[model samples]
Target chain A: MIRIEDLDFSYGRDGFRLTVPKLEVAAGEKVAWIGPSGSGKTTLLNLTAGIVSPDHGRIVVSGEELSALGDARRRDFRVRRIGMVFQEFELLDYLDVLDNILLPYRINDSLTLGPEVIERARALAEGVEIGDKLHRDVQKLSRGEQQRVALCRAVLTGPDVILADEPTGNLDPSNKERVLDILFRYADEHEATLVMVTHDRDLLPRFERVLDFDELCTPAPAPAQEARA
Target chain B: MSDSLYLAWRYMRHHKLKTAILIGSVTLILYLPLALQVLVDRATEQLSARARSTPLIVGARGSAVELALSTLYFESRSPAPIRMAEVERIRATGLAAPIPMHVRFRVRNQRIVGTTLDYFDFRGLRVGRGRPLAKLGECVLGAAAAAALQAGPGDRVNSSSEALFDLAGVYPLRMRVVGVLERTHGPDDEAVFVDIKTAWIIEGLGHGHQDLASVGAEGRVLERKDGRIVANASVVQYTEITAENEDSFHFHGDRSGFPLTAILALPPDDKSKTLLLGRYLGRDETSQVLEPVAVMEELVGTVARVRSWVIAAVVLVTLATALTMVLVFWLSLRLRRRELETMARIGCSRRTVASLVVCEIAVVFAFSVVLAGALTGVTSLYGPSLIRGLIL
Candidate 1:
């Protein structure tokens, strides 16, 4: 579902640079990327999702070359085919849980928010154990509940690939396990690829394969680590 | 677009105070100038309507504007008093009918208008209740005056004294409210109408006292000679003109020499009006004849000039408020930069994101417009009465 070869990316002049010689993950694969901070794990996710373009490389996700697509088409592909969860649970504070879950349909015209889609979003919220809090403001929820809401948003569109950047980084151990259970369950049910980046090595055993970030990205000429995603 | 509007509405709902503040600022910007215009237009209409109806005003040689104001509105202090002889002079001209006016006293906050019954006929005033001013001390209340004083027929109202400490000031005369005039929505609505003689009595020009020739007058009489009895200050004077003392109330001086504030001269035709106006234009004329319409127009012109200045000032204020509002919105956008970036990264196009912000502003503007329009409509409906209350 994802392939990258000869990927060269940098922040700017004399900044942190990342080089990926070769990487591939098969469809329906559940992979966890274990890395230190600033090891280019999140950067690889962004490139694969077409959120950022590589300076010199080819990126293929779900048989589509992300680097070849224009900005608008790439964005369309990302919303339609890939679901993304962030470390911060980027949900709008003004909206309730349901609106945050249905945000993809509202922000982009590629998807229509029909009654069926609403039903699906409700089902996803219910599956994440947040059905009762659908009308509550996201700010009023605990960190675990907020991450559950983000997971519902990512899976509501039923994308082919789920890219989560440390989705359980802010959760307690119990909430961390709950979030992973939901993420893994959705990927298994839909045969969707799951690429998660995390600092915790204890959670690596659940994935089909684990990739070390240092082995994937060559050492930068300068000593400073990359802070951007 | 509806989606964008929905999100915008949610954002506005979350920040209620900010939304309300924006609406209030915009509403004031739209309402101030509009309300001022409505009030000024109503004032102009009211001033012109009364002035246009009254063809001419004859008064003592002083400010024509003051004479018109006093004669027409019963507002402002009375100008120099013209003699009752001026009404006779206008009558002698054979070109117009004269209605003498005396507006010098007050019954509480209401003005006391002393004129012949012809003034009522000329001004289209009707007695809404009870009877007209038939007796020497009987008075009629205007509709608003009756409401303000809470008096009706058979009720007595004493004129307010000019000065409480001045021993020589006119004594308060208790006059009976014989009737009330129908509301005309003009200056007459706030006046207490009485006969010219009743106003003179209020001024102490006419008075009634005990009969010194009577059998009980022996102690009060200072002299009794040649069939004439002179009384001392101990003799009782009537403060109220009752039926018993009505016959004794008499003027001390010649009636023609009595004071009048102004005369409403009604000419039958344009030729008669021109002749009467020509009669008062002499270089030595002690009294001035003025076309009230002309004087009111001048006053309105001055008000219009001031209106422009006021509107200019409001516009400047509105501009400053608009700039401040823009700054507020710009700062809000800066604060929401992260939210906006999330929307864009989540696949909202630049246009869609911009549309959301625009929708928020549009809703605020729409609410302000509706509020301002409603306020202006209310002002248009009641502005004339408000101006009348203020001016009178």
Candidate 2:
């Protein structure tokens, strides 16, 4: 369900670079990218989500080449085919929990917010144990509740790939387990691919595959070239 | 666009106090200039209408604006007093009919205008209820004055004292309200009309006391020499005129010498108007004769100039307010940058995000326009009274 090859990305002039020769995750696979800080794990998630185009890369998700698509099409693909959960649980504060969950439909014209979609959203909120607080502002929710709201928003589109960038970074141990269990349950039930980046090592055993970035990506040779000059 | 507007509405609703302040600021910015323009236009129209109707005024040599305002609108400080003889002098000219005006006293905030019945005929003032002034101590109130005092025909209105500390000042006369004038929507709508003699009584020039020659006057009489009887301060004086004592109310001196505020002279033709105006044009003329239109026009011209200055200041203030509003929006945008970035990253287009901001501003502007329109409508409806209050 996901493929990347010859990925070479950089934050230019900062001398930071990422290199991935070949990486693939099967359909329905749950994968985790674990590494030290600044290991470019979150960057890869953003690239896969098409939020930013890599300097050079060929990325395929669900039979569509993300790098080949235009900016608008890439955005559309991201909204329709890939669900993203952020470490910060980036929900708009002005909106209540339901609006935050339905944000994907509100922002993208490809999805229509019909009565059925509203029913589905309510069901999704009920599944995540936030049905009663659907009208409460996301800002007033607990950190765990906010993450669940973000999870509901992510899966509301029924995307093929769920990319979670440390979804439980700010939660307590119990809440972290609950959020992870819900994410895994959704991937298992829907046959969706899951790619999560995290710093915690204890959560690694639950994933189908764990890619350690310490060996996978090597920094570019710009400083060596500078020394030679 | 609808979606963007819905999102904007939610954002604004979440920040309710901020939205209200913005709407109020914009409303005042839009309303101040509009209300001023309406008020100035209405004042010009009303003042010109009243001045054009009155032909001429004769008052003590002083500010013509004051004399015109006091005599025509019963507003401004009462002009220097001219004797009732001036009214007779204009009558003697055989060119115009003189209507004496004594606008010197007040019943609370309402001005009491003392004039003859000719004033009612000349101004086309018809009584809306009961009868016009037919006797001394009987008054006809203007519609607004009566409404303000909540007094109708058969109600009594007492004159307000000129000074609080005057130990021997004139007593307040409890005059019977015989009628109420139909509303003309001019200065006349806020005045009380009475006979000149009643005004003199208010001025302490005329009074009634117990008859010293009667049987009960033995203690009150100070001297009884010749045909004149002198009375002491202890003598009982009537504070009001009734049917039995109306005959006893008398002026102390010659009636011609009593003070009048102005004389309204209505000439029959242009030749008479010119002749009457020429009579008062002499260098040594004690009283000034003026065409009310000319005096009012000069005053209107000054107001127009001041209106221009006010409009210019308003324009500058409007520009400054607009700039400040823009700055506020710009700062708010900066503060909400994170929220906007989240929207874009969530697949909202850059254009849609921008539309959301624009929609918020548009809603605020729409509310402001409606509020300003409502305020301007109210100003237009009550413009005449507002002008009266402003000038008076």
Give per-candidate clash totals: 0, 0
The candidate scoring highest on DockQ is 1
lDDT tens string, model 1, A88-180? Answer: 999999999999999988888788889999999999988888899999989999999999999998888899999999998899999999999
Candidate 2 residues A1-229, lDDT tens each? Answer: 9999999888676666878998899999999998776777877888888888888989999999998888888878888988989888999888999999998887777778889888989999999999999999888899999999999999998989999989888899999999999999999999999999988888999999999987888755444333210
Candidate 2, B254-274: lDDT as tens digits: 988999999999999999999
Error of 1 at A157 (Å): 2.2
Off by over 4 Å in 1: A12-16, A219-229, B126-157, B174-185, B208-248, B384-392
DockQ of each: 0.61, 0.54
